[model samples]
Target: MYPFNCSQSTTTTCNASLYHATSLGRHDSTRQIATYYSVNETQLHPITGIHNRQDYLVTVPCSCGTVSGTTAYFHAVNYAVQQGDTFSDVSAEVYSGQVWVVGDEKQRFVAGNNVTMNLVCGCLDGKGTEEEEGEVIVTYTVEDGDTLAASLSRVVGLNELLTQNPGFIDVGWVLYVLKGSQVGCGDFEKGYFDAEGPVRYNIEEIEEATNNFDESKKIGEGGYAKVFFGILRGQEVAVKMMRSNKSKEFYAELKVLCKVHHINVVELLGYASGDDHVFLVYEYVRNGSLSDHLHDPLLRGYQPLSWSARTQIAVDAAKGIEYIHDHTKTRYVHRDIKSTNILLDDCLRAKVADFGLAKLVERSNDDELIATRLVGTPGYLPPESVKELQVTSKTDVFAFGVLLGELITGKRALVRDNKEPGRLKSLITTVSASSTHLRITLKNMDILCIKMVQPVSDLVRNLSGSSLEDQFRNWHASSLFSSYPI
Candidate 1:
């Protein structure tokens, strides 16, 4: 058993009048000061060698005119230490199902606060065994004051915890184990671990299936992680395994993806987590990304995508981006929207993927703006994003404009042939220049004359009265192409 104590320095002022109500006889107008227990560990337990459980005693001071009138209540002390975990991990275990007790008028006891109380050891043991692979496996028991990190440390190797659990063991997994342990001896049975259907591959099984992350099997690499093609349950799947255990962005991405239930968005098949790895499984799109079709010269000639097909692709991509911004409960700003990230299905439908840079904003608050590190591909990024280092849905709109320009002009965003100086420009510039020539072509083609001089005579008739005629006459006198019709 762990030794315990109470420190007077840690005491809080309480309502003396409340304690007097519980006592017999007369009531006192003076404030009551309650005495509570606190504990300090001097050494480890002799038998278990674990410096775990601590108990505290809380005494209510009351003037009952007798020694028996004064009573002390015993309560267990609870506290928490940070063990690097996702928010979900901490919330489910540490805060769930804990009851708060009312103390003096000025004070209250919370679950996270360190407390002292008396409780018997082994009061909650229900350890059993299961036959797995013809061998008996003993159930893991979490005694009082057992933390997930400590419990997993006692049973499995420490390296296994780091290697198998990407995030550190926090209250969330512990609460899950506690709740599951009360029900049965198996793992926590949630949607991801259902038994009605075929069993999905665990982290170990997925690693084995991918040939221990062979470089030859690598399909794609991104800022946060890598993609690999793998077979699971005899079905082809694309597995995006995260690169680091410390990425909060990866967890954010997973949270957003799991909540999104759109047909246009890529579906999440399954996920696996180990100490060093976090894997997201998705359905494989055989045709690959939109960037491959747009930029690859070898692919362009085989099947020339018509203008109508390109316009449809633009509309499909816009709908996906719009869905993230408007349809979701919280508005999502996909900071990174580029051709490469827009995946193409076999039927040529575009699905937006790679939400690692996405951010959720409040609906009611217009004043709220998020300022973080600048992230996105160059040339495709909007001017506001580049200058202000701010990202909003409007930023995505500007990027969409760039994508539309690419679709219309059939040219890359930055790449242009330098030899043909005035030959190529942006879609906006080309359209503006073409409009002038189109008007001239329409005028010259509209008036067909019997002789070449009659064309100039018709041009002079059209422009004889306007102010433009004076400028044309002045320009014609100095120009070498004066014979050519305007």
Candidate 2:
């Protein structure tokens, strides 16, 4: 993974030290600021990262020239207008937000100006040519009735096109399409523009598909969302309904899903957003999460996974994490890695899901640890995550190791109120005490493994002591654990 280096800034008063650290990994980087600025500002930059230049570069006259910070004053002002403020109203309070235009002499927005600025979409500018680098570019020719904006709308967001290519109007000109990077249209684009983003399903369509969100269709629920089985356009899908459309997790998941595409990662088909609720559409996996299969006795219709199937599930999940960390344009850390988030397909193949806590990191020095908020499920969290909020891909690896233990022992990570002394002891803490301890646990697992191969009653009647244990110990020493890095 690459390292991220943060740019430094100094204020005139006391030389305010902006502790700039290189991008540790995807888990540390944020999307609040546009890429036009530093990879991601961590200094005096706001929590959302986008702010006016005057606020930070007070002593400077031209914020554009102030290379100390890649301050985009217009972005905050843009957001103000997008939130329903008029030109006059926004300009009046622009200075308070420390916003200003670089070339404008008056240092204020001209009143009643429509063409001067795109009030509709303040921060989401342009067709994102750089953003669409890996996308397959296709061509579209303007029809007789189509305007330039209309022509481009068929391929990309009109506002984004206007931002990317200003004054693009030709009746018959050819336009390029960046396969799947279009923005959504709704109240979000009330009077501004229109285009397709990832699939957008109407609320009614979602309701109808899920039988009006019938309880029977409800598959799973989480801290911030719920998953329901649905059929849209004749294709089965899993619709994840969020508490609201504006939460940080919704945007985080959307941003991560927009960039990732791999068989091992759950495919995001499209989404629906509104003031009250947001729904994410994903390719449905018929079998439930790996946790349910491994630990839920009430889970119906499915037999226990074979030993080979368990190993394959781990391998598939590892590939998904590998793609996120190494193959993305930048490194990504799946902060919440657990059996619950690993779903099994009809063929019992595993695919990683739930990227609400995923982080985008840029490679700079090495895969340095960066500070972030501590957020993840209980037993799966690593020591650094719980102690200091310092995390790297190694954090996910630690969680994966715990998951592997669950698969091997056929036990949950945390066993509550068990006969065991430590009621909530994590599987890793228990079995990973030492190599000898792990070997002993594997030896007991050998008996469980044999039950799958031979009837337990017959094995008890016919088996000799230490024979099966010896065979498994030999295999475990040479074949099983040897093949795994853990």
Candidate 3:
């Protein structure tokens, strides 16, 4: 048992006593505790009659013989004012009971002033417990020298990765090692050695096809390349072996040709680049060139193109040019447009062949114009092109006009005729002299609906002025017409 005391007011006194006893083997033992004390305090306030000094004690028994304990006496000034009470009023009320001594600092907390009260206490035992764990997940880590394609092949199963993420894999995969010992996959940097596409063929395969570019296999030759008929993978192909190093123009032409899949444009199968050689593989066109058929007099009698056929060829060529100008993302200008550059397939369909001189328009600036060294066939070149007047699409139009004139007259733009000095000059002179007669014939047919005869007589008179009659007489004497047996 423990003794306890209760006291209040400035001069107070209280006392308590505790007694405990336990009997064992018929022998009795007892213990007693008593306390008498007076607590001192100062005057609190002038208002309330309550005391600020108070004390209380409690007693309990313990297992060991009777134990006693005492608590320190303390003065607690506790006064709770009702709502709407001013701090001064609360102080006054507290002092009236002599429970507290009001000071200037206590007066600062006036009524209607926001104030917060905080309580602090101590506990003997306070603790907390924790919860259980969850399941664990497993993953693999990519080490150094790993690629994105390889990592994906391992993580998601190789078959699924190949089928589901083909596009990602084909974009040249990359792997990055993170700071936390993790790995990531993405596209590789451009121009890196690993960024190249899969090789379709090796140098050995191409060499065997061309017979090591033997002179015997060479079918045609150009300014910078030689074309050979080669068998690649059991298929006939025309392989052009470039004579010079790679240039931006060559790559640009290749990019354009790859995208141009029109029937009227030559098809590009594939290209190969090596340390010392560059090769372009294209589909072989069996028929030769338009120039061969047109210029070789021996072949003319065998195949004389009809006017309708000529018109169709011109229209097809125009459509091909229009496509190059309109359909592509970049406008292409064929700086060289001539008959020799046009090839005819087995069906006599024309396809524009050479693109080495083509140029791509880069920007939308109006002042932009493509300028180059003088490079074109003299006879087919336009007058403006000769003077270099900022060549444009109109220059190609002028060249086409010359080709049309050639198809009509069946004569080369520039021909060497010794009988008539300066052939183009003489041709122009002859045409000018007969222009009046030709115009009258056309006019009569248009207005009078009459087939004129004097126009023919004027043509005969114009021919009589030159040595053309003598040439015709000698042609009649030759036996070239005797085979007709007429």
TM-score of each: 0.46, 0.53, 0.45
Clashing pairs in 3: 47-95, 47-96, 47-97, 48-95, 48-96, 48-97, 48-98, 49-96, 49-97, 50-97
Give candidate 2 regions above 4 Å deviation: 1-197, 366-372, 416-422, 434-486
Sort the predicted structures by TM-score, highest score first: 2, 1, 3
* Candidate closest to the true structure, highest TM-score: 2
> Which candidate number would show the highest lDDT if scored against the true structure?
2
Model 3 lDDT per residue over 1-486, tens place: 011121222112111101111111222111111111111010000111113112111111100111122221212222343466665443222221111222333554554454322111101111111210111111112222323443233323312433365334332121111111212332321111111111245667778898988889887877677788888878677787774474554575576775454446666667777777677777676665566545653554437554455545555555566556544435666767676676677657666776776776642444235476665666656555667645555445545544543443444546566576665532222222333332232223211101212222232223232343332233223322212211
Stretches off by above 4 angstroms in model 1 are 1-201, 297-302, 364-368, 417-486
Task: State the C-alpha lDDT per candidate.
Answer: 0.44, 0.52, 0.41
lDDT tens digits by residue: candidate 2, 297-371? 355656777666776776677767766765455577888989999999877888899999888765555464676
Q: In order, how many clashes per candidate?
A: 14, 13, 10
Looking at model 2, residue 214 earns an lDDT score of: 95
Q: What is the lDDT of residue 57 in candidate 1?
A: 16
How good is model 3 by TM-score?
A: 0.45
